[model samples]
Target: MPTEPATYPGYRFPAAVIHHAIWLYHLFSLSLRDIELILAERGVVVSHESIRRWCLRFGTEFAAKLRKRRPRPGDTWHMDEVYLKINGELFYLWRAVDQHGVVLYILVQERRNATAAKRFFKRLLVGLKYKPRKIITDGLRSYGVAQREVLPGVRPRTSRYLNNRAENSHKPTRRRERQMQRFKSPEHAQWFLSAHAMIYGHFRPRRHLMTAGQYRRSRDQALRIWRQETCARVVE
Candidate 1:
C-alpha cells in the first residue's frame, strides 16, 4: 500500500512495458541490447538505447518504492569486500547482508582502510535505522577499528567461514560485470548495482528451500507486488 502511487505522465510506452524491460535487464545477465531483443520477440519493438534510458531513470525509483514493502532485516549482519577493476583502476566494493542473506546496502570506495570502513558503517546505520546485534566478518583489522569507533557495543565475530553469505552475494554481480564488460567507472557501477541489487533481490526468494508450489506462490506474489509498485494503472 505504500508504493504503486506513481503515474506515468508523458511516457510514450505504458508503465507496464517500461517496468518489465527494466526487470529483465536487472534480474538476469542481460545487456540493454539483450533486453531490446527480448522485448522485440514479444513484438514490443523498442530500441536498446531507449530501454537503457528507461532503466537509468526508473530503476532506482522503482527499487526505492519496493524496499518500503520489505520486511525488517535480521539482527545478525554479514559484511564483506571485493576488489573491483574499473577502467584499469583498482577500487573496493563493500557490501553488507543480513543473516537471512538479504542485501542491506552496497558501497564503492577507493580504500579499504579504517576510514572507508567507518564511512560504510555510518551509511548502514543511516539506512537500517538500527545497529545490528552482531556482525560477522573476516579478521580485517579495519573492521575492528571501525567497529570500535562507529558500531560500539555491537558484537563482532571475526572468522574465516562465518561470512559466506556476504561473500557469495558477489557472484551474481561478477556475472553481470563480465556481461556489461565491466563498469565504466565507480559511479556507473554503483548506479547500476544500487538498483540491480534491490530489484533483483525482490523476485529471488531462496528457491532452494521451497517446494515448486511454494516457489510459484512466492513468485506470483512478488509479481503482483511488482505490478502494484511500478504500474501507474494496475493491469488486469
Candidate 2:
C-alpha cells in the first residue's frame, strides 16, 4: 500500500508559508480570514480554506516535532479545565502544564468528574513519563480523589490563588477561540488545541523569571530547537 501525496497544485507556497501561517494563527489572535489578509498584504495570496488546511496539517506536524525535541517538564504540575461551546454543545478542555507554564498535555472530554479526572491523569502520566511531585487544581474534588487513587503519594493542592498559574495559561486559548468564532466539533477543537499547545510551548519564553540576557538566551534556544526540528523533517 502506498501513501497518497498531498497536492497543492495551483499555488506553490513554500514550507515557510505553511510555517508562517501556523505561527500567525497562534502568535496573533487571528482568524483564517485575518491570516489570509495579512499574507495578501505581503504579496502571498492564499485562500482562507487553504490556510485552514495548512494549519491542521502542518501545525500538528510541527507541534509534534517540537514536542519531541523540547525538554520534559518538571515534576510540579498544574491542571485546569475550561468550558467551550461548539455548535451549541458544551465540552471541557483539560490542560496540564508544568511549573514554567510549558504545556504537558491536553484532553477534551464531555464532562469534568472523577472519571474524567482519572482519564486525564492517566493520559498525563503516559505523555509526561513521570508522576508529578505536586498537582494544583482549583478546588476540584475530583482531582483530590483521582490523585489519591492514581498518583497516591503526590501532594494535591486545592486553593484559590494557588491554581492561578493554570488559570492564567488559559488566556491564549480563550483569545484564539474568540478569533475562530468557536470550533465546529469536538474533534476539530481537539486537533486545533493540540497543535496550538505545541506551538505556544515552543515560542513562549519564561519572561516573568528571567533577566534580560537570560530571556534572550531562552528565546534563541527555542528558535534553535524549532529550526533544527524543521530541518530534520525536511531531510527525512
Scored by lDDT, the top model is 1
Best by TM-score: 1
Task: Residues 1-236, candidate 1: write the lDDT tens digits.
Answer: 46543447767787878888999999989888888888899988999999989998999999998888888999999999998999999999999999888889899999999999999999878866777899998878999999999988999999889989999999989999999989999999998988999998999999999999999999999999998888685333
* Global lDDT of each candidate: 0.89, 0.83
Q: Per-residue CA lDDT of candidate 2, range 93-194, in tens?
A: 999988888898889999999999999888877755667789988887998888999999998888878777788888988887887788889998899899
**What TM-score, over all chains together, does every model reach?**
0.93, 0.88
Global Cα lDDT for candidate 2: 0.83
What's every prediction's RMSD, in angstroms? 3.8, 4.6
The C-alpha stretches of model 1 lying farther than 4 A from their native spots are 1-7, 233-236
Cα RMSD (Å) between model 2 and the true structure? 4.6
Clashing pairs in 1: none
